[model samples]
Target: MAATALLLSLAGCQCSPSESDTASKGTNAFQRVTGDDVESDRSQWDQVYAQDAYVYGKEPAEVLVENIDILPVGRALDIAMGEGRNAVFLAKKGFVVDGVDLSEVAIRKAKRLAKEAKVEIATINADLNTYQIKPETYEVILNIQYLQRSLIPQIKRGLKRGGVVVFENQTVDQLKLPNSQGIRRDYLLNVGELKELFKDFKILHYSEKNDGKQAVARLVAMKP
Candidate 1:
């Protein structure tokens, strides 16, 4: 079932050129993708990758690093793990890792980075909404820079008992600040939304803030 979900998720990928347009005449390039049309096919990621290099530069996410001690030496999962940065990092730290995303191109790059990092990580190209996340399976799960509200419950269920989830992503308020045109409210999270959505679990940490153009909410929650 998970395999089927992975295959079907990439069936309609499309990346609109306008989706990559400039926010102003003389500003930095920002593609704040909006809309609930996450039904994108593989070609959409291909378009984005064609314009950039593999791995999108490899480095562990800081949030994951800071909370590394909480992660048991067991299987870990990475949701929307573009370029494999976090997965490879976990592998290096002695964890069996599985990375999932909707972008084949991104998965390829992630593989390349994993090889470059001399670490092994299983990469699954699948959309989160349809993917069958096995319950209580992983000791650590990472969700960064991606938002799909429906996946919250499954995420809690997918963790091993006492497992931890580190989530970091932009919020709706991010665009309210100055120079916020590169952000999309649809693609961003809302304040307290994370806590409310995953209220059944135990929240270890939570923060909502806008740092420059990045409006983000981060939480380290545990499944009882």
Candidate 2:
């Protein structure tokens, strides 16, 4: 009952059921927009890409770069892949990489990064809130710095048996700013939420800790 009420209150803002069910289909994902304006978020991110001169400055997240060797070889999916740093990194490591993001400019920049890095990557511009993950499609998945709470099931479902998912994101406590980037509290995880979501999978590692800038967690889980 509490969950239902919370979902209702957070509708159109968070990763609730409806968003999870239909995120991929929308050209204009108002629900996924950080705040009231999809055009604004799109323009804002486009400017960020432009300001950086069409290069997202592609470098893998520190955590992902450090643990690259641990990823099992196979098809991989990277969510909210800004600049395709993680995706290109995976490709360099010999994995077939597909990266998805919301910003077309980001996708283009990611492709440019991949080309510059001398690697191949597939980049998709889509709203993840409504994107559908094909069941049992990938062997390894990388989701870093992007949180789609309702994606827990899609991630699990999209992984082949023995598939691995390395997911890292901010926790509710990471909201140190006076106002968050419009990400709702209900959408952010509390400690232990990731572990609990993948409890059925084999957990290679799971940690919830602070890294000075944020309260965050990383989970490496394998589908049974």
Candidate 3:
């Protein structure tokens, strides 16, 4: 009942259910975007990507680059893959990468960046909340600076048996900083919540650190 009410309230903020619904097909059929918050969220991202320059910069995340060698370089998925920086990097390393984000502007920029870098990456303009992750389909999965907790189960199932997952995002400690990004509390992971969430998997690396710029929880794990 509480979940239902929360969904309703969020939907009221984003868009109508009828407006947000995507086609029900294959794995996408079961998981659907229930409200307007998702759409409103996408609009904000689209605005960000529409800027003259890449907001987060063109480089792939440090966490991703540092752990790239450990990952199995086959089919990869980058969720909330803003501008495809990480996806493009994986493609350069010979991984067939698919990057998904809600903003078409971001996808266009990602494609442009991939072209300039002479690497190939498939980009999907779709909201991750309703995006269907095929089971056992990807050898590596990457999530950076994005938090969609409900997608955690799907991420686990989408990996091949020996596949790896690299995730890095702001931790709850960010809220303590004076000039923090003001991220929603719900989106921030607790001190040990990241490793705990993937406890079933073999955790290779886990850390919580604040470099005086940002506070984050990073995790690298592999499915057995």
Top-lDDT candidate index: 3
Pairs in steric clash, model 2 = 22-130, 23-129, 23-130, 24-130, 24-131
TM-score for candidate 3:
0.83
Candidate 3 C-alpha lDDT tens digits along 18-105? 3224211122211222235666666656654575555456678888888988999899999988777789899999999999887788
Candidate order (lDDT):
3, 1, 2
Error of 1 at 143 (Å): 0.7
lDDT of each: 0.69, 0.68, 0.74
Give per-residue CA lDDT, model 2, range 83-130, as digits (tens).
Answer: 777799899989999898767888887888889989999878766766
Clashes of 2: 5
Superposed model 2: Cα runs more than 4 Å off:
1-33, 37-40, 53-57, 176-183
Off by over 4 Å in 1: 1-29, 33-41, 51-56
Ranking by TM-score: 3, 1, 2
After TM-score superposition, what is the CA distance of residue 3 in candidate 1 from its true location, in Å?
19
Compare the candidates by TM-score and give the number of the best one: 3
TM-score of each: 0.80, 0.77, 0.83
RMSD of each: 6.9, 9.7, 10.5
Tell me how candidate 1 scores on lDDT.
Answer: 0.69
- State in Å the error of residue 46, model 1: 1.8
Given candidate 2, what's the lDDT at residue 156? 91
